[model samples]
Target: MNTIVQASPVTEKSRQLVTVATPENAQYLTFLLGGEMFAVGILHVKEIIEFGNLTEIPMMPAFIRGVINLRGAVVPVIDLAARFAGEPSQPGKRTCIVIVEVQDGDLSHDVGIMVDAVSEVLEIPANEIEPPPSFGARIRADFIQGMGKVAGRFVILLNIHRVLSVDEIATLAGVATPGEGVAHRSGS
Candidate 1:
């Protein structure tokens, strides 16, 4: 005797094949400043280096920790906490310098930003992003792109162009004019 085996029929819904479109996610290099997490677009980040001795420049803003020689290039380092919140930097083992490319006037300068810690690169979906709050942010809202929801908390996404504006940095650098004991004032 021959036996016939029947296969289960596929339903219309099953045949439709529900495809969860992977949401377009952006990758950001996350870092910690103070107690909060902040992210910068990965495209701008060049490299991360351990905190080390920096050559201090006179007459510069307090935020400008000074410059470091990286492969023969003089790159200025900015303390993110001091620059944003006007607080002093207390670097620890996790402290690192994230070298980035910033544009100042007609010049594109390579600058280093010091962070409390270097967090992992995060892939955040666009839908999970929210607009920057008008009042809740510790730093100026203009400096932020929006708050990103990550692991049930918000990570502040920085608008690098605004946060590291060349004009602003130049202004800060200009505060210490040529001569007139810039080094003494900066404690260099």
Candidate 2:
């Protein structure tokens, strides 16, 4: 399957600076993955779609469940569970895909992330957000953006950009397309 991302024009709405939205009023789209609460900044979110049949491609990474033709664009669907853990995500009644926009240089691409279910959008205050724990996280430390405290509970704020990095994933997946210039780490 061709996974090259085509660039689209940036919109005026997206031109608003992220700094304009402080944590005090920042919104997050919370979702469940492996029964754990996780969130992504709403600004990075494009939309959420119902779970649908996907076209599977052979020899791809396990985390890469398949691709879905979103409109006319071929968007790759990622199994979030498989990416973080080592197993594929099981489809549940509330299963769905969250379309997230990831930046590649000056261009943007929309990628689908499979999740157990979407909870709600919440406003997490600055005081309630804390730095990632030094350890004890199920996922890699770099994946976490922060720990948001809500209703006396902690929600994992994901660094979506890092998680959905096309070039990084493509390089690490051993399918780096020429001219993408996705640098691979030495001696993993």
Candidate 3:
């Protein structure tokens, strides 16, 4: 799959302002996955929800944990670790779901992503961000826009739209009716 990375545009005027306001910076919602910290652009995040009951969908990819009712809308939730790193999620108190809006073609859809924990929102200066490595990244580099340095550690900045745009997950509800999978669970 071709993952599109949006680069922060730089202009001469913006460069001059960077000395003070740092206009190249983009706000990111930092979160935890496994033991590492990762972030997604703040523009994509809609809300953060404490882990709750998820109605499972049968015959779907294992990465798809299930769906959650968000104010009457059934949003499919995907386990980030399993979806990217191919491992099962072991939930803890810190686990939570981040609701985000993604665009598929011309349609905008809201999807929920499960993360180990919700951290803080941070503004990463463009200069502190480096393009994703061609190799050595644990997960597919396509899912990453770049790596941002925060508190001296690298934070994987994910391209949320691309990460959850898999064809199967997009068509799950349309193909299978609700409550088709394993029984609903009380928490993550």
Candidate 4:
């Protein structure tokens, strides 16, 4: 019989993984931000891209770095650091953007989160996951989905939906609907 292999939550701490057996498994895409590890479910991940060609929008919040032309789609890129109440990210050599799809009511929107680097995807058994703590996290507690144990360490699994809530972000940033938001800059 061919054993089934699956992905789980993981963060590379000198290349180690941790897990526990459960009836179901989950996969997570791990990445780094400010030297800390974070993961998001693979289902939400659309693609990962090299960070570049950002068209900065005026008067937007710091976390809303700008928009990128992703295959003709205007995907907004977010700076996780800034969103987490830290200084803006200074793009590094390993900097990249992880594209994720978020739902707003009946519609879906694509958003990009810039990270310092992309780590490997791993198969995390459900039993190894722990509930989010009430406190002691760098980011807001509500933003965490769970904590995944990995090789005696921990990876902060993010509640991507809550973290990237389209409605909340737009409202907080004072962004208007597409038609009313951006003014065309001619020959800039």
Ranking by TM-score: 2, 4, 1, 3
Is candidate 3 or 4 superior in lDDT?
A: 4
Write down the lDDT that model 2 would get: 0.82
Q: Which sections of candidate 1 miss by over 4 Å?
A: 1-23, 104-106, 175-188
* Local distance difference test, candidate 4: 0.80
TM-score of 4: 0.82
Please tell me which model should have the higher TM-score, number 1 or number 3: 1
TM-scores for the candidates: 0.78, 0.82, 0.77, 0.82
How big is the positional error of residue 121 in model 1, measured in Å on the Cα after superposition?
0.4
Expressed as tens digits, the lDDT of each residue in 116-168 for candidate 1 is: 99878788899989999999678998999988999999999999988888667
Candidate number achieving the greatest lDDT relative to the actual structure: 2
Which segments of candidate 4 are over 4 A away from where they belong? 1-23, 177-188
- Tens-digit per-residue lDDT, 54-133, candidate 3: 88766666788887877667788899999888897988988888888888667677888999988787889999999999
Cα deviation in Å at residue 139, candidate 2? 0.2
Model 2 RMSD, rounded to 1 decimal: 6.2
Higher-lDDT candidate among 1 and 3?
1
